[model samples]
Target: MTEFQILVVAAAFIVAGIAKGAIGIGLPPIAVGIMTLAVPLDDALAIMAIPTLTTNVWQAIYGRGLLRLFRRFWTLALTATIALVVVAATLGKLGSAQASAWLGVMLVVYSTIALLAWRPRVSRQTERWMNPLMGIASGAVAGITGIAAVPFLPYMQSLDINKDDLVQALGILFIFLIGALTFALFRQGAFDTANTIGGLAAIVPTSIGVWLGQKSRDALSPEMFRRVFLIGLLGLGLHMARGLL
Candidate 1:
């Protein structure tokens, strides 16, 4: 790989890690988006697997409510995992640009809802049916577009969970998503030695960025930060939506 490509990947991870540290999200989209500017989409996706998995595992397990979240959302997790694998295997047959457009739509809808504070509260009885449905939708989305943040993140936020648990729950969800994504990529033969090494090298910058972002998260109000993050997602969605135009 060229030095320039290496630098871009490193920078992407640092930026993404910082976002993850602060918001418990953004790593995959930011890293893949930036890395794809210099690397092939497949290579970029391959490189993201390990770092994404390791970090989210840490995030998921760091909090006290891991078991509770796992029990409550296991259906969503299981469905997303199975659906993603199926989608990933068929991704070659599906038009990737079309998938991305759908993701763009999802991001726009989620960001709009968040900004408006239009919470569609899910009743306990309703959650049982809805959670698995959300899992299928998000899993299919992630399998196609390599983004699991759209309906999944927004849906999780609407649940009656506390702030810290929300963050941790996102971590748990990402763990499943990234793991499934990695498996799919492997099955598709996307990884090569160079990019694999690059992925490992990316861990350092990502860690540094995550540390900085975590410090910032401690200092800032999560609610305010999340609001700003949603606005950013809105802009990202518009950019992504241009693929359809």
Candidate 2:
């Protein structure tokens, strides 16, 4: 990568890390979304795989009752993984423009839902079947767009889990999703040595940004921060979607 590309990647990840640190999620969406402005979708996705995997691994293990939660959500994990691999192996051939458009759609949809704070409660009875089904759908989106946020985040948030558990569960799900995505991208030859090294290099700025965000989380208003973040995403989404035209 050129110096300019490196700087762009660093800046994007720093912002993504801050969001993740502040809210316990959002690293991939922010990182990939912003990086796409400077790099191709495949390159952005390749660069994100390692950093996202490592960070979320930490997030997943930090909380209690993981085994129990994993057992409950294993179907979701399995279904998402399988679907993601298939989509990556197939639709990944459509090239950057298509993938970028798909990503734009996902970001806009997710941002809109987040901005509205419209929480749809999923009944316990519905959740029994919904988890795996949603996994399939989310995996397809992730495979095509290199993001697993949309329905996955919303679905998890709708659960009855406590704050800490919810955070950890999100980490676990991301770990699974990102891990699978890494393999899928590799199968498509997306991760070259340079991109992998770039991903590692990004960890430094990302960590710094996250630390700053964590420190500021107490002082800032979460609602305000989230609103601003979503609005930015909405704009980025529109910019990305224009590629399709």
Candidate 3:
């Protein structure tokens, strides 16, 4: 990668990380868009797999005790993640453009539904079934486009989980998805020398962004953050759609 490209990827990482840290999501869509400007989409996807996984793992395990949560949702999370990995692996070699276009459409549709609905409620009994079902759907999206936030968002919100638990659950879910994607990408030979180096270079900025985001989290209310994130998703979806079309 050129010096300029490295700088761009690093900057993208920092921004993506901050967003992920503060909002508990947005890294893959945000970072992938930025990175694609500097590198191939597949390489960007490959490089992003690890950092995304790293941040989610940190979110899942950082302050929240894992044992308590793990026992509760491990089955749902693992099943969803694994399902996506299998789907993604099956679609190997289609390249990232088609995936990006599909991702763009999904984001726009999902974000639109989320933004319009208020007080969306689901019963606990429904959640039990929805969890795995959403996981299967999310896995399919994540595998195809590397963006799985859409399917999981509504379910997460309906649970009325506190901010910390929401973030933690998202982090755990993302870690599983990213880990699966990393392995799938490797098996598909998505990583090359340049992309590998570029992905590694992004780690520093991404970590810094995460730190900054965590610090800023308390200043904003969860509702406000959610609104902003949804808006951001809308904008990203539009931008991606325009590019794809």
Candidate 2 matches the true fold with a TM-score of: 0.97
Q: Which lDDT tens digits does candidate 3 get at residues 1-245?
A: 78887887887898788777686677887788677667766787888876777677778887655777666567668777788778977876324777777766777877787678744777767777777787887777778877676667666777856777777777777777787777778888888887877677677889998788777787776456657767877777777677566
List model 1 lDDT by residue over 1-245, tens digit each.
Answer: 89899999998898788778787777887787667668766788889888888888888998899999999999999999999999889765222566556656666776787688776677778889998999999889888877787688778877888888988888898999898988888888878899899888888999998998889899987677667767876787777677788
For model 1, the superposed segments whose C-alpha errors exceed 4 Å read 93-117, 219-233
Off by over 4 Å in 2: none
Span of 10 residues, lowest total lDDT, candidate 2: 90-99
Best by lDDT: 2
Worst 10 residues of 1 by lDDT: 91-100
TM-score of each: 0.87, 0.97, 0.86
Error of 3 at 59 (Å): 1.2
Q: Write the per-residue lDDT of candidate 2 for residues 62-104, one digit (tens) a residue.
A: 9786897798788899999999989888876523788889789
**Clash count, one per candidate:** 0, 0, 0
